[model samples]
Each structure stands twice: as C-alpha cells, then as structure tokens.
Target: MTLYKIDEVASECNLTKRTIRYYEEIGLLSPQRSEGNTRLYTREDIERLKKIISARDVLGFSLQELHRYIEVVEMLTGQRERYRSITDLEERRRQLEEIDDTLGKQLDMMESKMRTIQSFKEEAEQLRQQVREGMERLGRQSVERAEAEH
Candidate 1:
C-alpha cells in the first residue's frame, strides 16, 4: 500500500496543489489521511487524478462533464462485478451480455460527443473568419466615406 503525500502527488502528476485540493473539494477525489491528519494518497487516487486530467486536457471535457463520466464509469464497473459474480450460468450469460451491450452504447455516445465537439470548433472558426471579413469591409467603407467627406 504505497501512499504519497499531497505534494508528491501534485509534483508527479504535474498538477498544482490547489488544483488537487479543488478536485477533492468537488467530490472528484478522496484521499486517505495520515495518523497526523495529513493527506495521504494511494496509487488509486493518483491514477484517478491522472484520469481526470486526461479527460480534461485531451478530450476537452469540462469539470462537470468529467465528473459525470467518472460516476458513470464507476457505476458500470460495479455492475459488471455484480453480474460476473452470479452463479447460475444462464442468468450470468444474460446479465453479462446486457452489460456488454450497455458498455458498447456508452462508448458510441462518447464517440458521438467527440464528433460534436469537433463540429463546434469548426463552426466557431468559420464564424470568426466571417467576423474578421466583416470588420475589414467596414473599415474600407469607413475610409471611403471619410475621403468623400474631405
């Protein structure tokens, strides 16, 4: 049971201490405590923080979104464990298949969300270009008007 202090976790993960604390405040992380009440993080906590960071940085997920994603993943994993423990062969097979299908659907939805994010970026870029072009045209119009008035 290797445990790391808050500072070590922050340094190893390249995260600010404040950010790690904020994740704890937001119910995203739960680290154990030392006998002296100091924050002691296990490997699981470190991994979870890294997972959250990856979701945020690589996938561009908002904090709320990442929190919900973690919750859903944990719930599904728990459900998987329960289904795997069933003794009856037929029932176990049915439950396992259902869980598998649900997981597949969840993955499909995430892929769709990624595609939507890409589309949003493209739309924003296009609108930015339009705004820039409009501003240039307005500037030219203003110059012409000033020259005529002179």
Candidate 2:
C-alpha cells in the first residue's frame, strides 16, 4: 500500500498542485491523511484523478457530466472502485447513447445556423452594392440638374 504525497502525485501526473487541490475541493479526488495530518494519495486515487482529467480536458466532458457519471457508478457499487453491476452498466450505456443523439441534433442545428448566416451575409453584400449604385445615379442626376440650372 504505497502512498504518495500531493507534490509527488502532481509531478507524476504532469499536473499542478493547485489543480489537484481544486479537484479535491470539487469532490473529484479524496486523499487520505497521515497521522501527522499530511495528505497521502494512493495509486487508486491517482488513477481516478487521471481518468477525471482525461475525460474532462481530453474527451471534452463537462465537469458536471463527468461528476454525474462518477456519482451514479459509485452509488451503484458503494465503493471507491470501478463499477461492477450489469444493470448499472447498461443504464450508463443507454444514457451515453442518449447524449450522442442529443449531440447529433445540436450539430444539425449549428449547420442550419451557419447556412442562415451565410445567406444573410450574401444578402447584405447585395444590398450594399445596390446602395452604392443608387448613390452614384443620384450624384449623376444632381450634376445634370446643376448644369441645366446654369
């Protein structure tokens, strides 16, 4: 049962001490303390912290979403360990599938919005050209009026 201090774990994971502390404050990691009240992190804790960072920063999971997954898994198992129940895993899989569907819908919406914006830009350019032509015609008419009056 080898344990690492906060600094050692942070250096090993290429993360800053402040980031690790913040994760702890956010209920992500929970390291134990020695008899002298020094924080001692286990290998399991390190693995969980690494997973959280990877899921959030690398995989683009929001903190709230990742926390919800972790909480459900933990609740099903009642352990600070990986989940084991078949039913719970199935439920998680279903939830993930729903998330995928929702993301697909959002992507379709974004594409539609992009098309609309592009159309608006084209219309604006055409309107600008028309305004320029109108101004030039008005200038020519004004010159003709001034010459006739002279």
Candidate 3:
C-alpha cells in the first residue's frame, strides 16, 4: 500500500515529471492526490506506467492506439465483472464461453501487431547493415585514392 510522489514515479519509470502529468491528462494514468494536491502514485500506477512505456517504446503504439486499447480493456473488465453477478449456471456457462472467444480474438490481434512491429524492426536492421557497408566501402575507396595521389 505504499504510495509514491510524482518525482518518485518519474524516476522509477524513467520519465519526466511533465510526461507523467501529461499521461494523467491523457487518461493513461489516474494517480490519487494528496490534500496539498500533489499526485500520489500507488504500486498499480508504477506497473501501469511500465506497461505504457513498453507499449509505446517497444511496440511503437501511438497514444491514440493506447487510448483505444485501454477502452477495450475496460470494456472487457466490465464484462468479466458481470459474470460475478450472474446466478443461473447455464447463463454463466454461456457468458464464460463468450468471454473465452473474445479473449482469444484479442490475443490474436495482439500477436498480429507484434509480428508487424518485428517485421519493421528486421527491415530497419537490414537497411542499417547495408548503409554501414556502403559507408565502409566509400571510406576505403577514399583512402586508396589518397595513397595513389601521394
């Protein structure tokens, strides 16, 4: 149940204080506030920030995409909560089946996105290697020309 101040959160998450505040503004975070109006971050906030960083920096998902994903997550969470209130065994089983199907599709969609991002990374690496080879060749040619001139 430990809480962190904004500074602590920024340091722990490797983000600027402004960036953390901006995330709150954009609905990516919802830190509680002290009586003095200072932002108070819980352990859940820290974990969520890590996820956000990975989603943005590693997966290359834009803020809008993150927002949309959050919406889908919240919707799914609500659906799961509804199962707790269901009393009839048959109805619960039906709801559970629906949840399983939806979860599978969501996982598939995430896998597809990861594959696409990996493709882009591979392409960039190949381009980088080609550029490096070209630069090395040019440097060698320049040196050869200089020796010949001498």
Candidate 4:
C-alpha cells in the first residue's frame, strides 16, 4: 500500500496543507498517522478531497451541506460493498432500496442548489435586460436632442 505525506497530498489535490488539516479538523477527512504522528494519505483520501473541493467550489455547498453530502455518499458506498456479498433476494432488494434512498438525498441537495443558481441567473439576466433598455432609451433621447439642435 502506497502512502503519502500531507504535502504531497495537498499538491496533488490542489489544496493547501492548512486546508487539508482544516478538513481533517472539521471531520471531512481522516488520514492515517505515521509513527512520528505525521499525516499519511492514501489514493482514496486524495479522491475524497477532490470530491470535497468539487462539492465546495462547483456545487457551492456550504460546509454543513458538504458534510451531509459526504455522509450519504459514504453510506451508499458501504451499502454497495455489502450488497455484493449478500445472496438472499429479499436482503438484496432491501439494500437496493436503501441505496436508492441515499441517492435520492444526494439528488435533493443538488436540485436545491441548482434551483438557487437558476434563480440567480434569472435575476442577472433581468438586470442585464433592464440596463440594455435604459441604454437604448438614453441613446434615443440623445439622438432626438441632437436632431432638435440641428
């Protein structure tokens, strides 16, 4: 198993060392520790950090929301792993239902954020249209004034 120190992980993940530490502090990450108490990260840890960054920067998730999102994702991951081992049809069906429910929660969060972003985009478009109209009105008034002077 390959392990990396914090600096390597931070550089690879495009995050600062402090940010990685903060993520660990906030329960967003849990890297292993070395014999001297230094943080050691695995490839999985780097992937998780990337997910966190995407949720934060792309999805505009608040820390609280990100936490919940990560929780659901982790739960779903575990459920998927457990699903492969079970042979009972009823148990597999139940596991599938749980996975579906977990997926629904993630979808809900994304849909809520999308709705908020869509509203903001609409407001911006409205403002842009208003400004365009105002500019055209002013241009017409200036033209009329010039024509009167001529």
Model 2 clash pairs?
none
Error of 3 at 99 (Å): 2.4
Ranking by TM-score: 4, 1, 3, 2
Highest-scoring model, TM-score: 4
TM-score of 3: 0.65
Model 4 misplacement above 4 A: none
User: Model 3: runs farther than 4 Å from truth?
Assistant: 81-87, 118-150
Question: 1-150 in candidate 3: lDDT tens per residue?
Answer: 899999999999899999999999999999999999999999988988887898778656789877766655666777799888999999999889878876875677578788998899999999999999999999999999999999
Cα lDDT of model 4 by residue, 1-150, tens digit: 899999899889888999999999999999999889999999999999999999999999999999998998899899999999999999999999999998999999999999999999999999999999999999999999999999
lDDT of candidates 1 onward, in order: 0.87, 0.74, 0.86, 0.95
- The best-first sequence of candidates by lDDT reads 4, 1, 3, 2
TM-score of 1: 0.72
Q: List pairs with backbone clashes in candidate 3.
A: none
| TM, every model | 0.72, 0.50, 0.65, 0.97
Clash pairs, candidate 4, are: none
Residue-wise C-alpha lDDT for candidate 1, range 1-150, written one tens digit per residue: 899999999999999999999999999999997789899999989988888898788777788878877776676887788887899999988888877877876677578779989899999999999999999999999999999999
Query: What value does the lDDT take at residue 11 in candidate 1?
Result: 98
Q: Between candidates 1 and 4, which one is better according to lDDT? A: 4
Residue 113 displacement (Å), model 1: 3.2
